[model samples]
Target: MNTETTNTERSTQIMHTEKQIEFDKIKNIWKNLAITDYAKECIQNTEICLDEVELRNRLRDTTNSKEMIEKLGTPPFQNITEIRDIMAIGQKGDCLTPYQLERVERVLVVVERLRDYLSRGKQFYNSLAYYDENLDALPELREEINMKIRNDGVDDRATDRLFDIRSKMISVEESMKQKAEQTIRNNKECMADTYYTLRNGRVCVPVKKDYRYKIQGSVIDKSSTGSTYFVEPAGVAKQYEELALLKIEEENEVYNILYTLTAMVIYAIPVMEENMRMIEKLDFIFSKGKLSVDLDCVEPQINLERKIELTKARHPLMDKSISVPLDFKIGETERGIVITGPNTGGKTVAIKTVMLNAYMAQCGLHVSCKAANISMNSNYLCDIGDGQNISENLSTYSAHIKNVLEILKEVNKDSFVIMDELGSGTDPAEGMGIATAILEELRKSNANFLVTTHYPEVKEYADKTEGIINARMTFDKETLKPTYRMVIGEAGESCAFYIADRLGMPKEMLENAVTAAYGKGAISNYKFKNDNLKKKEVKNVIIKKRKYHKDTKLSTLYTIGDSVMVFPDKKIGIVCEPVNEKGVLRVQVADKKIYINHKRVKLLVKSEELYPEDYDFSIVFDSVENRKIKHDLDRKYTDEVYHYDIEK
Candidate 1:
């Protein structure tokens, strides 16, 4: 398949999964050291294969001879994108400059070196020499270019005539310098500093401005202060002109040599292009080998049968120091696995490890595991994270369902799907039903799938369903912490109360929550009734509420008249009622009243400090005018104004 198609498939397969990020990270490492853009592109487009003998052979060759390969180090492969342009130019009978030809020469040297390196050991690197015949080596071309071009990219001693022309130019220029120096010495009395300098590419003498007419020559330049005049003596003018002409001839000769070399390279473009492809392929292979070594990876055995047996597999992108190694399996006796675990218990990490290793195996790279026996699937699919699309106005559940629909449409018998927290983010009952139905469909198609969930009903379904098994992340009940270990054939219990208690939740509150979830009976008892052993007696058990001892200091912390601010809600209120059995206080804010946990309200004003010994609470609880109106209404109300509002 083409790269676009492969990328689209992988995008859908691991789009919401952690493997998406992990894959990019792996590709980035390869791109960083890649010699050319084409080589980097090859790394990106590498895909898993099932029956590619040549690819496997190359991988084996590199892996087997890694040490020897490392000895050669990285080859000097330069960017050759402009080579195509140069070739096009030469095809139209145009010549290339020395700079362009130098680049081509450098590439040829690299190609020749790589070919020689690989050709050294005929057995180990034999498979990598697939393009050896196509590469011309072009030793003659390399020699000719080296002879004509200097290491600094200028023309060297290539042709005898060009060399002679440069020699004559150098000697004539020296002669001009000597003549100018002699002229300076002869007119030392009229010269400014007795120094000979060059101006306008000709030797000149610095003559004093007052004696400028003493030197009979052309004026070349003058000092900024105008105290001295730079003069090119008439004696050396002809020799300088001859030097310029010789320099022009030298440039022409260099161009001819460059054109000859460029023509030679253009003629061998076909073979050179083939050789470049081979070098890129080799670069890509060695990169994989280097990554394998870096990640402590091992080659996994590929099987036609659908199965994944990963032992001590760790997420390649995670911190190795603290990362938990996963031992997971599928498609042996069971085709579907439902992994139930608490949050942050390595469930997502486990799923990513499986998917990434599978992708790596298919891409012909070694996987990060001690031992792996992975089955080749037609497609690798997953829905492992929040796929929310805010711009599309899609909720997390909608995004998840959209991905599931796409996966369902594309999955086949040889497909592998990994879903994290399946049947979540919606109504528990309906979501569990939908998840069960989807799992049934996947099982019916014989597609290998692994799903993680928090629903008890899903776990029960896995317990009863054929070819489906339940797994869980191990939790330590005493420590109230997850161990991040996956255990098979067991359903995990959600120890919310224990965890909450360890996090400093109130003991009474945790007890009530646990009782509510597990029922009031702390223990179960069996009794026989009606003279039959099968019929059990039913007893009405009453659970007594625990009473708290009222401590004087605690009870007086917030009194009836205390002004307080409710936390989280941030409302100002006065404590109108005493603390209850639950340590919650009833506070009144303006016209509204709310009951808040004692710890959730902060005392702003103490009752003892804010009120008098025999204070009338009505003054603080009600407005002054309302209190006055109540007083008038409570009385006989003899006046008309006070009596008018009594009924209203």
Candidate 2:
């Protein structure tokens, strides 16, 4: 998939569907197994196996083995990638630690046991028949490491000399303890306490501070109060040094053994990696099978027809007992679906259900439905939420548009798209127009898409469009509630006023709203006249003429060259002529002349009030160049000014 579609799927929350919930549940189950990080990655990136044979094989394996695997209990597997890395290094002749070698032994032992267990059923179970027993279990290597390294990570009796050294060290330590005890008894009077202790890995006697000279030993540690001395007697100091040297030799011997064992395992790295991979694949398969059992899901029929038919489908995350089962189909009969309904009527949920199930089926996981027939698509994209980005200065509409634009570029016959509340968050007329155009483009592209909207025009377009069909969420007018049932081939009503009346809104207001929405006859069925009917009817009447105060009359207040502000448009302009009999005035705004309704224009400054009584009116209505030309002409012919003024 392209990054744009991938990002759209994630950002739209289309991937965060019921299947994701199922995926999470399966992940939680695998957590108990403590699988390797490599195995976890394999599981996480598991995609829809488009190959029919491979997909069916996986489903069959899971279905056949889920019970047997559950009875056998979860396999005990530890993440061994680190151990594998150490083995890789050891292959280069580098020494490994005792604990690292022990881990290698443990992993081999587990793999060997798991392999045997799986191979045992190869003849008895079809699921186990896929197990390849020919893969090397590395049994000899495991035994060799086991013999060299103890479970506690200490070197066992692998070398005769190392064993002899440890034995001699233990004997020497016992003798040193006895010597210290005898010394403590001989110096009982000088000792602070009648006990011997080991300090700094050497046997010591706690001697009184004042009698310290009597001990004939070197002080290793002093008591906090300086009342006693922890002394390593000069007599057993040589034995302590010998034991320390023996430990160093033992460590070197253990390292040599570990390095040898690590190298042996490293020789079998290819087989070991293969074995780990097989086990991980098995774990992932069994996990999906276990999830299927838990969710009561069934393997769906996969096809290349670019269609889906779901019967009694429920969102996987919902409570099956109460979740409304939906019968949704697309791609076969119609390439696009336009879902229309009022708010809280399950339109969004229905679209989400289709998207989630399609995704799950494509991912090779059984969907939570009675039966499903799904087709694979190359890309799945959705625009389902208010994708507002404040950092980019994008509003909800802009964000939706941006997503749609990306979708338009990527959509094809093999793509599946789900969009929620298309053409929302803007003016209804233009929003509907943009939504229709998008739908037309999607149809032309031949991609499968599902969209929800409240616009009636969109619903009409869906009805008339060839490849699109209309569906709605059923609403109960009597109960004033949504039934949450999706009914295809129908258009849903908003029922706003009816629901409002049922919610105890004022009846007269609801009646007026209904009449306004539908027609005067919409509420004619009501037997009683509304108490506020006369008042509303009076308010609706249009007056042909308005009585204004003499001072506010437009004809008397406005004159030529007056500055005024026009209503509605709120533009300021200078009046070029007096108000006509029809209450119209000619106004000059900049270089443009416009006719204004006299009543809608408010007089700001009368020409007589702003200028001298004899000021020329041409300057106010003409450009600066024209006024200058007129001024120069008048200077040349002052007598002709009277003639020009008369002609004007």
User: lDDT (0-100) at residue 80 of candidate 1?
Assistant: 65
Candidate 1 off by > 4 Å: 1-21, 48-78, 82-85, 121-126, 129-135, 224-227, 500-515, 519-648
The number of the candidate with the highest TM-score is: 1
- Local accuracy of candidate 2 as per-residue lDDT tens digits, 1-648: 999997776544433432323444544544444366765676655555667777767667666556555556554456677876876777777777667777777777777777666666565565663575744668788788777777657564888977998998999899888888899888788888888897877789999889989877789998999898999888778788888988999878877776677678778888888877776667666666667667777778888899889999887777788789999888777999898888998887788788777776776677778999988887677787887889999999999999899889878998888889989888665788899999999999999999999888898999999989999999887786788899888877676766775666566666655553444566775433224333333233211222358666556656787767665455778888777778788888766778866756665556766668888878666666566667878678543332222112
Candidate 2's C-alpha runs over 4 A off are 1-34, 43-75, 120-124, 132-136, 155-160, 208-235, 241-245, 505-512, 520-648
TM-score of candidate 1 against the unseen true structure: 0.75
What does the lDDT read for residue 470 in candidate 2?
95
Estimate TM-scores for all models: 0.75, 0.73
